[model samples]
Target: MKLLLLLLAPAIMFASERTVTMKVSGNCGSCKKRIVKAAEAVDGVKDAAWDKKTKVFTAVFDDGKTDSASIAAAIVKVGHDVEASKAPDAAYTKLPDCCQYRDRTHD
Candidate 1:
């Protein structure tokens, strides 16, 4: 009975959601629209907003289903630069001229 109680306790104590704030460089309004849209598109993301002043993306997501790093990666996947996340080289190079965010390593 005690073992069963302890196992259940951890589940009940776990968080359901988490909020994250992180930077992603961008140039203009189009970047804002694209970044915000991509962050919201992830399956477990609950909400997302971009701070133009700080160049940051703020997001809330279900902890049980998602995480901040994955959210950052998703943003990067769509052609932006987050602090710890990066677009794959091939993906970065394919962007239209205006969508390019930064120089990436050539392979």
Candidate 2:
């Protein structure tokens, strides 16, 4: 039992839950949905939320399985721009008219 506990200690220590917040570009309800969905889709992400008014996105995830970079990449892939990653032109262009935040003045 002592050996088992010792062996599992490292794994338990490595699997820490972390919360990260960053600015993301978005405009409306659809944008919020896309942002949250993209962030939450990453492996190890427990949950995610976005506030359109503030353009801030927050995510809770296991550091052992994922990191902020991966979460940002997921959001970028789905047509949103996060502090660590930018959505590709193709992805950005695919956004709906109401969700196109880049053309306007925003954070």
lDDT of the candidates, in the order given:
0.80, 0.90
What alpha-carbon RMSD in Å does predicted model 2 have with respect to the real structure? 2.6
Which residue pairs show backbone clashes in model 2? none
Regions of model 1 farther than 4 Å from truth: 1-15, 103-107
Residue 31 deviation, candidate 1, in Å? 1.2
Give candidate 2's whole-model lDDT.
0.90
Q: Please give the distance, in angstroms, between residue 22's alpha carbon in candidate 2 and its true position after superposition.
A: 0.3
- Residues 2-96, candidate 2: write the lDDT tens digits: 99999999989879999999999998989998888888879999999998888889999999999999999999998988887789999999998
lDDT of 2 at 60: 95
